[model samples]
Target chain A: MNVIDHVRDMAAAGLHSNVRIISSLLLTMSTNNPELFSPSQKYQLLVYHADAIFHDKEYRNAACKYNMALQQKKVLSKTTKVRPSSTGGTTSALQAQNLPSEIEVKYKIAECYTILKLDKDAISVLEGIPSRQRTPKINMMLANLYRKAGQERSAVTSYKEVLRQCPLALDAIIGLLSLSVKGAEVASMTMDVIQSIPNLDWLSVWIKAHAFTHGGDNQRCGTWKHFGI
Target chain B: MNVIDHVRDMAAAGLHSNVRIISSLLLTMSTNNPELFSPSQKYQLLVYHADAIFHDKEYRNAACKYNMALQQKKVLSKTTKVRPSSTGGTTSALQAQNLPSEIEVKYKIAECYTILKLDKDAISVLEGIPSRQRTPKINMMLANLYRKAGQERSAVTSYKEVLRQCPLALDAIIGLLSLSVKGAEVASMTMDVIQSIPNLDWLSVWIKAHAFTHGGDNQRCGTWKHFGI
Candidate 1:
């Protein structure tokens, strides 16, 4: 079997040592003979090496390789699109099937940033994804990342937006609830947002906190204090 | 104004110093004259203080206070549930309204862990939430926490499960794509999963990568290298 085939098999079998060895060899071979490898091959080689490094927790290096793959992908798409007819239908099909979407690649890069604790870079990459295209999962990710970065207002807003889209969204609900409970005047916009959740069991809890903090029918709270548990 | 009212007003107005003064007064008064504040009221004081500290980014302190608030809430619930009639309907309503849900409290705790970079603790808290009760946001949160904790196999599995439930789940898809691209053999179940994604532009790329590494008709790849972009 050729080196690539043996490496592929080793990778499929979870042979990290073999996968690493072949990936390095392939990368070196491709690097020395750049013209011999097609753009897609270049992308694949970078990804293979990145994947190997990434598996070893070499995130920074992996990120660099993944970045190069994306660059190759971009160049491949642009140049290939320009000469669609010369490459023909098969080429079109190949191009269409191969190459991760821009969002997918960016997401990978963002994940790398996150692993490295480069919160700002991770947010930047994730933010590149269009808002309308954001799935609930993506929104949650963005919200958490924002929260971690201590952009409290933006984080709370993103979490609330997730709640607005889905009332049952527990993470956002938890996010909002925590934000409400943690000390942002329980009377602000985030506190007010509890009303948006339909019949949420925790709504009353927030309301009570607001009442305690802001002057809401002290007599009722007093009566509870006098006799209530 | 009574201490609670004064504290509430100050907290609402973002007057941290004034809120602190009133809350302290209430706490002391409650300690001196236990009858003056109900368990809920005491819990509210702790939360108020916690909130203030939390706003100041005193997360460790805030977390401690929040934990105490939850302890008070737990004790209050137990005692209140036992003597339902003595407390009356208003008391029932008050108790119900005043205490955050167990899930909400746990979520807040998880937030503290996340801020502390205690990813495993965050995951444990989030995972305690029942799967059926998990909103997309929660699942995403758990998945990410798992990933952050270096539970890659579990992370990829969770991401794929999210994708199974939601084909449009971009984060999960990207997660799977990245997992597939990074180090694991491109020819395994990960590659097979690409077939499940309908009309995704990136499926072919993974298939191509797998095929390239594992020896899938090298002639085709060879031809592509010769003429394909």
Candidate 2:
């Protein structure tokens, strides 16, 4: 089997350190002999190495590798466009290959930054993603980092975005409440999303309970017991 | 769409709280009318409810639901055997439906127990998994729980099992060395597993560095700079 297959097999078998070591060796070889692999193959190798390093908790090195992989991907795309016929593969085939998107790479980079306690860097990386393409996971993460960084307004906006996409995200609701957003307003935001569900009145009650608890309204919090928590 | 479809779509959309609430409602309806679903369907519902609850951070309730799911799966397998023709589906079809295995359910139960600070319960649940079927994840969790519960010998055995399966499991190696196992001995254990690698003499150096750090032998640890970590 080729070295890539060996690396993949080791990864599948959960020999993560071995995968990291072997992938690093392959990456070094590719660096020394650039003609050894096509641009797409080089990008894949860098991502594999980065993933293994990430799994091994070498976040700083993993982030560097992920950045390198991103650059290689850009090169692959540019080369594909400039000389489409020379690449020896159809563009459709290239698209079908399970390559990670730019957003995913950035998300991973942000994850490494988060783990390294560079919240500002993580936030910046996440913010680079266009708002139209931001998933709830991305919004929630940004909300959390914003809250941690004392960017209350941005945090509130991000949390609201999360609630818009996923009304049942309890953490996002709590995040908004903790930022002094009104409990009633936050609970109402979920109303449209949950209208289809029968007998979901208890959800609003649950949200109110969280809000009351966060706002220190002990009397209203006590009333939730009547609904049988 | 049916309630099940709704619940699934909500789950896919990351509306975990909605999934939990709706699944609970359906579960209540199914309880009132036992004929509403087949044994396997009931098992699937219980697992869905348990997963949603798990995601919602309600560990105690999630554990209960998972246990109930396991019981339902038992009923499913039993019913399948007693009247295979009456179930309206082939046994293989039932098997192909992505139901969680016994080991997987036990792992989830153990995870909840761990999160709830019930380490003893977690250890017992993990221990119930037959020895031969224990994966590295199970063994690693069991090892950590054993260490926390002051069962050093059992922890050592489990960690060793982990290292045996995946020699590059750095945490397990560190786990062994932390229990006073010699660095050289731990390093030697990985030799047979990693013999295929062309240049891996640095692995022993890496292990020795960890050992020196753990043993507080700073003098020897300083020499690792020669290898360029």
Candidate 3:
């Protein structure tokens, strides 16, 4: 089998710990056949390497590799001179269509920063995203970053934006609920959101129970408990 | 190869996503030859199944299986009348030495509770452990559970116990530092603890730099930045 096939097999088998070996093999193969891969293929390989690093919790290394992949895409786009797609800008449209979006790469980098406890860098990277391109997921992440950075008011605003777009967004609801975890009156609001998420497991029931209990809404708490906690 | 051997190969290959397949195979094998396995082997097989479940993130199911394994051990010990060892106790001494401790099983259950967002249950499970049996790791977990349950003072006390036992305990240091993450006085203390963790990277340097900057300790922040953050 080819080296790429072998790497694919390893990844398919979930052997992430073999990433360093696969990377080294790729390096050797590339040196042997300089023209074996296209720039986009090389970019994809770098992304795979970065994902492996990210999974292994080598956040800083993963972020650096992701940045390299992004840069490579920029270079590819300039050389290709492809027309802009209907959705994104001319520059990004010319880049690898199969690879993750620029915003997604930046988001992943910011996640790595967060894992490394660099909240400031995470927020800076997240906030640098063009407002028009910010998806609901991005808003949720920005909310998380803001919360971690101790920007509670900003987090609330971002989280509300997420909820406004996708009212059933579990992460956003949890984010808001966590703010008032020790307080009251958010119970009714939380209960409304909780209805959107399916599979009312013990976690879900316990959340409502805890919320109502804390909210001093004994009637609601009784109803939740009666539903079988 | 035997069923157990096949299961071992599956686990070694990191194919935990095939847990259900393994579980079914184990079941069929056991039913085909009920007497083929000894009592200890049966217990071991149950532990293996539970481990598969645990690795698959089936926390609720895994906790139940772990509990069943523990109960099986209790029954086995009663029937065999095993003696206590220097390391563990009467009931657990009869168990496989490599298998997790009784306290460890309880800890794992508490971890599942934490993941389910059942902080209260987690605290209760953790607190149920006898003080004499609570190791440094257990204390750290208890501290984390306390922190999650919003019992900050208790969490602080438990974290200090961890630090007292092993001054280089990273989790304990991080736990305490996270409490005063925005404060100044703890920066020096954090730096002192940071020295204990080896292979310090830019991430570590950056954290200290950010902390000192937030703490308004210009001298320390300058020193950290000067080191090439």
Candidate 4:
């Protein structure tokens, strides 16, 4: 049937939300303005609409939307194309490509593997990122992966690397600090951090005390009040 | 000995990097100005320095630092008393006098438990957060947790919930989308997304296609090429 007939039938069949109609029109328009959609709108339909469907328990439809999104991203990343525009304006090259830079793509791939519970695969993808270019975010992810995989030694290293990469990376710092302080080594360099940051000294001490309690250092933990923190 | 004396001695002892001086001074300051540090700085020191200590296999020192931080946090949290400032100004409460109000705290607590290999504890901490307030972040954590626990039903539900909460939450949407779009459903929602947002059609297709591929739907995955996204 023609697009119009399909629309009429869909309307007649009560499947005429703007989402459905727009989706149908999008298919027709794809022949022309292939790259005309915005990420936000695409996200809304592919991600959001699909999510709503998923939430409504329509797993099949939701899956289709997600698959469609990924397909679009792959094409943008691997191919270069010239497509026509819907407006009368000359079809300027649409650069709102779904393809992220190599680094971003790698990160996304890692994230996907992690989501799939393929820890080894996720680690492999993350490990492929050249060290220098590994941002604090990636380091954080690595730390999480290590921790999740029960690689405490590696996780510790990644967490430290995060701090070295971004001395001000609060999340990483907190993770590290919480670790040491909880271990009851307040006299360690973690204490130096509490000292330097000024505002968090008390918290550092409190966490330290908790660590002491956990570590059987009741002597230090009980004296928390004496220190006046 | 006075703080300056300690610095001089440390330098004489071949510990002259600004890092050492800063660390020593920070340690001293932490003793007096428990509330003078910022949370980020405090967390940083805990992570970087404390992590080094822990990894140096200096569990003893690491525990000390961790204890100190925890003590400080607790005092700031449970106590109402204001800490005196170094400049003799009115009391400045640098530490977190109150519990963390952000969702990250839950995540951090979860991290702590994870590090301790207390999976049940970590899960419980996360479960305490109100669902509405839970971010895409916590969803990922919960998904991982459920996945690890081999609760496939729960894991899938959590993943699906993430999509429902954020239709645009690509991570979750892609996971579920792959399921339905593996040639199971007629064309992934790429067309629909593009139709919804005409200006950036490829983005819609890209994300869906990506989701489809990730979901392991090799068949419908090819449909993405049809759109040339």
Candidate 5:
């Protein structure tokens, strides 16, 4: 196996320190012999190195490496397009190799920014993804960052999007309520998402209790006790 | 693509009701035309059908399908072993196809059991996995189930196991504290996990705040405000 593969195996085995050392060493060696590795290999190496650094709590360095990996991936994508016939095969093979996808790498970069308390940067990275490509996880992250940044309107939109995809996401429900969304509106949205689920009437009651508790409507909250809370 | 693959794609595209209908139809067809699918294909179909059912909030039926998928996987494994040389190739290919692993299927079954409020069955499904293969997610689920079952000692052990793997798991920390674990012991354990992270001395303070609050020691909790809470 190649050095990158070895480092990946070490990573899979949870030998983070070993992976960090080997990946860093190989990355340095590649600088003197650039032709020694393909663009995809270089990208994978950088990600592995960054992942190990991230595991070791070096968020700043990890973010830098992840950014570099993203650049390398862009380069790889460009080169793959030049060889049209092999593009599909190469893409599938890389996926089989379990390298981080572009979206996953971006998410990691955002996570690093979040840990460093750079909420704006994190939000930008997440928002840069095309809306159609945004998964529930991405939307949840954006919703949280928006809430923290006090962009209540955007937070409300993102939280609602998350609920549409995952009705059982209790945090999103609470997030919407805390953002001063009308409880009835939030409950109506939840009902639309969960309508197909049979015998889930208690969920609406539970959500009402949360809404009342968050809204500080103690009179309404107390009435929920009739449902046995 | 085949019906199972199409169902998976539909599920991924958020066409859950379509997946439920088509997968159910395909599963019934497979009963008559058993020769039409390979064992792995059969397993994948069952998982997809169960996933759709699970998504529709049919926990009991989903649990049954997931259990059947597990049994199919066992048959697949035994057949795989009979062809020794092809074992490695088949296993890797199966992984590339993104079929759920045995551990993941077990976790899903446990989730269904948990939702059905069959705490004992949930605990048993979780515990049946070999200890080494028990991931933090599994341990966390098991820990919650154990706590609910009032098996305090097992709950404590599972919570600690989760903390060891994931120090930033705030819920596990809270679980430990709520179980009446000594505040000092829990804090010391957290310190060991976060020691490598720079400028994270505040994490210890944060954990201490949680511990004191859970312990109902208001005086110590109040003292934390000097660190700005």
Candidate 6:
């Protein structure tokens, strides 16, 4: 089998640790036959390399690989001038033709920063995302970053946004409830999440534990106990 | 407060990223006052230093500090044989002479081994615990370690031990159910855990998400819905 086939077999076997070796072999092979891979193929190779780096706990290396893949995908889109069938060209050609969205890349960049414990850089990268494209996942992550940075109030607001986007965002909802809060808001949000998330029993139990520690009403605690929630 | 107090204060504040400065200052202070701290105080200080090392992504340093703390704790116990009333101690002089129980020290040693990802060392340390004295907490950790080591059967047995000791050990119950044979055994364990666990909803969700993954229940996909579990 060819190098690509071997690499595919490795990935399929979940031997992600061997991706670097695969990348090195592929890169050397490609040097002799530069046109052996199309843009998409090259992007796939880079993504696999990124996966290898991530699995190896080299976050910076992984992030760099992802950035390289994104760049290559962008160059391919520019050269090919291919339009994505969906999005009606509403998204920039760069994003539409790329392997991942700009928002996703930015989120990944933020994740790398977070892993490195560079909270400032993480927040900065996250803040670069446009308001409209800030989906529930992004909001939830931002909320977590805010909490990590010790900016509790900002975290609450971002978490609230997550709940608004996806009412069943349990982590965000629970985070808000854990904070010192108005009685009415906590009760309403708690009720909302209970109805929305189909099997959120364990999360509710954790919340109840927090509630008991912080002296929430006996009725609320009793409700948790009674429902086996 | 002296230089030591300042360093201790920084540690207490969770600003542990400055290992270079902390270590340098500690080294200088230790050089100046070689006999300044009591053995217990020195050990506690070493623990703090070890935490900073871990935070700094210096696993080697962290491991060394932890080893020092364990060794120091042992040496101090030998010198100061008084049984402190703060924690319960068996009336047996030999048992009381130690800082904590064999289980507790073994647990710490296991923790250090885990941080270094010396799975073999960790396994040995944990397995050294006499079966009779192993508590639910230690059993749960050992089960997790076995799972990490891909010794699924051992993991299952350890988790079962945890559940046998404490039926309400939610984590161990979930772990045990996940590793058990598919079909009737898993279903029975699920029902058993669902019945006994106070937080049924949460426990169900966690188990279904994880356990179903292992059992490959087609009905329970999308995190935990695949097994119809």
Candidate maximizing DockQ: 2
How would the docking of model 1 be graded? incorrect
| Model 2 steric clash pairs | none
Tell me the tens digit of each residue's lDDT in model 4 across B1-229. Answer: 2322333333233222323324544565655776655543454344334433443345556545554555545444333445345424433443322222335545655655666666787788788788788765576667667767766666666766654533333444444443443422322433453365325444466565766677776787885785664
User: After superposition, which runs of candidate 4 have C-alpha atoms over 4 Å from their true positions?
Assistant: A1-229, B1-25, B28-71, B81-125, B128-132, B153-157, B177-196, B199-229
Q: Show where candidate 2 strays beyond 4 Å.
A: A9-15, A88-92, A192-195, A227-229, B1-72, B79-87, B90-98, B101-229
Worst 10 residues of 1 chain B by lDDT: B181-190
DockQ of each: 0.03, 0.14, 0.02, 0.03, 0.03, 0.01
Better of 1 and 6 by TM-score: 6
Give Cα distance to truth, residue A221, candidate 3, Å: 8.5
Query: TM-scores of all models?
Result: 0.39, 0.62, 0.41, 0.34, 0.51, 0.41
- lDDT (Cα, tens digit) per residue for candidate 6, span B1-229: 3334444554553434432344444554555677766565566567666777765667766667667777887877775566464344444345334223335656766766887889888899789888888866577678889998899999988877765644334455556656664433434554654575332334455555655666676566576442233
> What TM-score does chain B of candidate 5 reach?
0.87
Error of 5 at A174 (Å): 0.6
Candidate 4 lDDT for residue A44: 30
TM-score of chain B of 1: 0.62
Tens-place lDDT per residue, model 1, A1-229, is 2334334444443334335554665566566667755776566666656666776678898788888888888888887778778778887787657544556566667768988999899898778888877655456667889988888787876766655554334335455555554423333433433455332334345335445433444555553342233
What is the DockQ score, from 0 to 1, of model 6?
0.01
* Model 6, span A150-173: residue lDDT tens: 889988888788667544344454
Considering the two chains of model 5, state its CAPRI-style docking category: incorrect
Q: Is candidate 5 or candidate 6 better by lDDT?
A: 5
Q: Can you write out model 3's per-residue Cα lDDT over A33-144, one digit (the tens) per residue?
A: 7676656656666766677788677999999988887887786666566644534675465544545567877888988888888889888888989877877667777888
Residues A22-121, candidate 4: write the lDDT tens digits: 4544555653655655432343334433433443445445546655655555554343343334322333233343222446545655655565577897
Tens-digit lDDT track of model 2 for B107-219: 88998999899999999999889999998878888988998888999999999998887666767888888887889889888877556564455667778887888888888
Candidate 1 accuracy as lDDT: 0.60
